[model samples]
Each structure stands twice: as C-alpha cells, then as structure tokens.
Target: MVVPEPGLPAAVTIYEVGPRDGLQNEQGIIPTATKAAFVRRLLAAGLPIVEATSFVHPRWVPQLADAADLMTALRAELGDAAAELPVLVPNERGLDRAVELGLRHVAVFASATDTFAERNLNRTVDSQFEMFAPTVDRALAQGMDVRGYVSMCFGDPWEGAVPIDQVVAVGTRLLDLGVGQLSLGDTIGVATAGHVRALVAAFAAAGIGPERLALHFHDTYGQALTNVHAGLQAGVTTYDASAGGLGGCPYAHSATGNLATEDLVWFLTGLGIEHGVDLTAVAATSRWMAAELGRPSPSAVVRALTPPTE
Candidate 1:
C-alpha cells in the first residue's frame, strides 16, 4: 500500500535517539551491558545514526550513570563505528569526558522558554547560551560535530504557549554558537500540524533552512506523527525518534515518550519515502528491549507488528 507523496523528499535521515534520550528517564537503571546490546541491536536493524548515551552527570540522570561504561563496551563491540555514535554533553565537564573518550559527535540541550531553562538547566534562557558557547567552541575545535536541541519549541508546561519568535531567537543563538544542526523539540507534544508548518517557516525566515533543522516530537497528546507529516511537507528531511516509543522529559512530568521510530518507519514506508530502516527489525528490537524493561512498547506499530510474546 505504498503511495508516493508529491513534493516530499525521496530520502530522510532518521536520527535514532532511543539509547540516550529514550532511556534517560526510565525508572530503573538498565545495566550498561543491556544498554550496549540495545544500541547494537538498533544499529544492526539499519539505523543510520543511533545516539548512544549522554555524558550528563549521574545525579541528574541515574539511568544512564554508566554512560562511560556503555561507550567503552560499544567501542569494544563496534570499534570505529562507535566513534560515530552521538552523546549528550550538557556542559564543559561532560564535554571533557567526551573529548577524553575520543567521541566525535555530541549534542547540547537547551530550552526556548526561560522557565524551562531554569527548571532544566538551572540557567535563564539567555545564560544557557553563555554556558553552551564555550562547550560548542571547544567541541568544534576538537573536530566534533555538535547538534543543538531546543526543547519547549511549541509550548511549555510552566509558561504555556511559546511565541514563535521566541523559539526562533533561541534556535538562532544555538546556530550562531556553532551547532551544526538544530533539533526543534515539541517537548510536551502539544503542537498541531499547523504549528509545525509555522515554526518551520519561521526558522526559514530567520535564514535557517530545513537542511539545518530536524524535528523532535513527543507523542504525549498523540500528535507526533501528524507533526512529522507537516515537517515533511515543510521540507524537513531529518527526524528524531525513539525505538519502542521510550522517552519522556524528566523535568516535564506531563511529557510522554517520543514519537516511536517504528511508527515513523511505518508512516514513511506508506508514503514511499526512503529512510533506509528495516521496520520489522526495528519492531523486533523494540519488543526485545521492552521485555527487558518489563513493560509493553507504547508504539502502536510495535504493538501491532510484534507478536504477543517472543
């Protein structure tokens, strides 16, 4: 039932964020070995860029406390390929650890609203950039590719509706600070398809084209896939999704798991778009991981495609 959509990109890059963002807020500490295995499974399933883990402090995200250990295991398991995995480096200390490990790709988290910035980063919206500037500069000097994540792009729990111009301002500052790409986060999944188009248009108007942007949507309100369709129509070719729909904002309790990678694959497959992911394999991997986590996958595609038990 493949149908080609007019004006959509023939190919899209699925930036897999399951390992880091997906597991960051989990209740239990997934063993480093299990985390490594999960990442390996996703890569084997044809995920192009699997974000492996975060270098953020263990206190803030206890689930990924073994970030270094996971990276070490991945390096031993995947060798040179492990260097291509992306990790979140929240500050200079995190960057130092990443540099020490010879990691090549890193991402920084930021918030569009001042309230969220203070809650998440303990800094105001403007000051978060000051903190990220040095980290971005150092990472770039060390030959690392940096991706900036602007959360609360659509709306905020504390601040309610966020202005489009405010989102643009935060995103542009990250770009100005030398981030190679921007991942606009609908952190609480409150965005509609129209909001998606308007935000993309706003970014484009600010001279940041779709080529330099990626959409990261949460499925809290069940609008994730809808927003993705609008992103595609607006010429966005990169998306951030989690396998098995496993992730939520730790700072924002209302935010649910991300748009599932399996669901994204299904939607893209139906549209005859090229993402190079094996839908069956991803579903299988998610099923396995869900068993390990002692929960059912929240992804509709995974639930529909996978057997009741494996």
Candidate 2:
C-alpha cells in the first residue's frame, strides 16, 4: 500500500503540537512529569520538531501552569534536544520565560478576524501586531526564530466566512513583524477543501509561498484531513497536528480537537510521502496518553489499528 504520489512533496515536516496545544485545553491539569514524558515519547518516535509548551499566564491556561517547570524537566531529560523544541509565547512576558529557560524556538498566536482577536487576544486584529512587534523584536534580538499562528483563517464562529483577503492581510502583517513562518489556522474547522486551496493560493499570490507557511486545521466539521490534502497539492510542506486528536480552542467553544498526528502519519505513509514520523509508535503513544486522560483517542487510524481495551 505504499503508493507514491505525483504532486506531493517527497518529504514533509510534521510540526507536532500535542505537548503544548493539545494539553492546554484539557479540563484537568496534567502533571509536568507526565507532559515531559509525552514529549520524550514523541521525540523517541521520530517526531522531528515537537512543540514543548506555552508560556502564557497560568490564569488563562491553568493546565499549563507549570510551563517553566515542564521546560526545566525537559531540559534535564532531553538535554540539548530540549532547546530545539518550540514553545508558544503570547507576549513579552512569555518570551522572557522562554529566554530564561534557554529555549530558542517560539511561536506567537494571531487572529485573522476582529471578533476573535478581541475574545482571544483582547486587542483588535490590526493592533494585535503591536503587541507582538516588541516581543518578536526581542526574541529576534536574542537570536530566536518566531513562528506566527494566524487563527480563523478559514472561518470564524462569530464572524462567519472570513474573506481570503482579510486572512492574507493579517498574515502578511505578522510576516512584516519578522516571524520566520506563518501557520494558517482553521480554528473552528469550517473550511472546505476548495476554501483551503483558495486561501493558500491567495497567500502565494502575495509572495508568501508554502515554504513560509504551515497549515493548522481542526476536525470540528471533519474537514481536517481533506484540507490537508489540498495543502499538499498546493505545495505546503509543513503541518501542525496533535497526538490522539487531543486539542481544542480554550477560547472558541465551537472549535474541536486538532487533526491527529497518527492520522496524518498514516495518510503520508499511504501516499509514500516521506514524513519522518513512525506511525505505529505515534499510535501507541496516543493510546498511552489517552489512558492517562481516561478516554479513547479520537484519531481514526489509532482507533482502527489499536482497538480500545475493556
């Protein structure tokens, strides 16, 4: 079943986000030790780039209240590899924490629509960059590469269909602010495959090729995998996925868990695309994490291959 695809890139970089984005929205707090183990398992399974944790204020995401502690544990366990892990830094304060930990890679969250910006960031869409500007500057000053996440690129629950132009506008502003890459987010998962291609095309027209972009999709409406296919055809080589499908927007109630890493690996493997992830190991890890959370994994590949135990 290893069929090679014609148009897709030979290799893709799976930006694993489970440790950070996946656990942030959990109702119960996961221990720092458990979180560190999750990252270690992922790295052992051949995930090239795993996002470690977020530095946002604990008041906002209590589940990741131990961000600093988790990073410390990861450093002790993984050593130099820990610094290669990416962390989400919401603003200057978060970036400061990352700097103190000697972390080198970081990401900042941005919103495409005004409503989501107000709710998630407490600033207007245009003004949100003002908040990110200094943080991006300081991170760059310290020789860190910052990835920008543009949420609600496809559709917003409050604003309905987001215009392609508006999404590009917000994305380019982040690029202007010096983010090395931008991850387009389908936050509520309302996008269709056609919409996904259109948005990617729009960015391409703006001189933002797939080389500078990553796709982040949710499975709220079950369009996540389909959109990934579109991204592949459109030449996107980087994707953001969660393990066990374990993530949703803490701010957007309508949003659901992200596209599962196991599922993405299965898809890539079937197409003969050289994604460096080990699918069997990822599924096993997801099952282990699901056991810790006392739930079944939502990934179709994980569920089909590793049946739930009694």
Candidate 3:
C-alpha cells in the first residue's frame, strides 16, 4: 500500500488539457468529431475537469477552428458531464462565442513577460491585462467561473528566466479581475523544483494560497515531474497535464510536450494521493490518442505500460 506524503493534499485535482492544449499545437487540424470523441474518452477515463476547446480565431489557431462544432457535439454526447468542460477565450469575442454555446466556464491566458505577451497575443504585458479585464469581468457577471492561465511563468523562450515578482503581479491582476483559479505555466519547461517552491512561496506571501493556484509544466528539460513534486510539497492540489504529453506552444518554438497525464497519475498514485483518475485508463487513452495523431506516446509511463504490436 502507498503511504501519504507530508505536506501534500490528500486528494489532487488533475485538469486534463488534451483536447484543447494538447491537440491545439498539432500540425494537422483534427476533425471536430474526432476531438469530441477524444473528450468523451477522457471523461470516461475519470477526469473530472477537461479543457474542451479554445474559442480563438481560426486564423490564429486553425486546429481548433471547429470549437463551436466540438462544443455542440460534446454537449449532446456528454450531457451533464459537459458541465465540467472549460473552453479557452482569448477576448470578449471569444467569451461571447462561449456564452452563445451556453458554456458556464472559461479560461483566459496571459504571459509573464512582455516578449511572450507581444508574440502570443500581439500585446504588451500591461496591455494584456487591459485586453483581459473586461472579458473576465463580463464572464464573472454572467455567472461563468473564469480560470486564468499565466504562461511563461518560469521561463520565456525570448526572455529567459522570468522573475517571480513579475509572475506574482500578473497573477494578482488576474485574481483581482475575479478569476476563480490561476494556472502558472512553465511554457518552455525551464522550471526547477526550487523555482516551483519559490514561486508558490511568493504567491502565498502575496495572499494567494496554493488552493487557488494550479501548476502547468512542460517536460522540455525533463524537470516537469520534479516541479510537480515541489508544487505538491508546497500544497498545490490542482495540476494541468496532457494525455500522451501531446502539446507544445506554437509561439514558443522551443517548447516541448506538456507534463503527461499518465506520468502525473503514476506519481500521484505512488504518493498515496487520491486523484480519482484511473492510471490504466489514462494510459490506454494516451496510446489511442498517439495513434490518432500518428505519433508514439510521449509519456514514459504509457510507453512502459503499453505493449507494442508485432
């Protein structure tokens, strides 16, 4: 039997980002039907919270251009489970689209550094707040729970090694805008365990508890799991991960795959943390998704557990 680790939450919430963040970076545009089926499979695998799709303009992210179609199909297929789905909204327009679809939850993204903000959103860091404020306020007023994603919280490809204070400031602004949760992203995966601890400590010092924060790390330098360990040690209970590790930032060219869902589930299981996610089911889903994407599973745990076909 596994033993509970000190300073870790008895249960953790795994925010599955495969259908949205994972497939969004793929070169091929996944069909809306395929994407909807993928979301169903993830829900069947016991993921309570799954990012469904992004409402970004097709010119920017053509892969998820069928966001509306996907949402429609998911609502029809998943029924009440559809309530757990959250879509990404880039602006008020995106939020409007989400509201039209009857979405009750949405996520808005901002970057820690000016370079990333300018490149990713075509706005400066400060301007990003201006862009997001009205959207966040509108969403909250509509009774929609908003989530804030702070990208490049650890390191930016253009601007390396972001300062903790800068990340905290952006996070504070997001929270002030009434976002219920903030997900700190290691976009280029330059975070270490120490960085995770320091960032969480800084946020805590600013009165933002770990309960309101989620950690999203990529495995570019192979430190994603280590950073997750640090986050758990620091009392963070929510984490964002992709099945089969299927994502990279198109804007951040050097970014690798996200922290794999299978890998994180394995770690959580060993730590005696109750995540309510089935590791075997997630591994199977990862393998299936890798086949759909025409790539091998990027998750080490999935590869180890899944037998190869002759």
The prediction achieving the highest TM-score against the true structure is 1
* Model 2 per-residue lDDT tens digits across residues 1-310: 9998798999999999999889899998788889999999999999999998999988888998899999999899889889989999999999999999999999999999999999888999989988999999999999999999999998899989999999999999999989999999999989899998999999989999989999999999888989999999999999999999989899999989999999899988889899888888989999999999999999999998885453
Q: What is the TM-score of each candidate against the true structure?
A: 0.99, 0.98, 0.98
lDDT of 3 by residue, 182-241 (tens): 999999999999999999999999999999999999999999999999999999999999
Q: What is the overall TM-score of model 3 with all chains considered together?
A: 0.98
Going through the candidates in order, what is the number of backbone clashes in each?
0, 0, 0
Model 2: which residue pairs collide?
A: none
- Cα distance off (Å), candidate 3, residue 85: 0.6
In terms of lDDT, the poorest run of 10 residues in model 3 is 75-84
Ranking by TM-score: 1, 2, 3
Global fold similarity of model 1 (TM-score)? 0.99
**Ranked candidates (lDDT, high to low):** 1, 2, 3
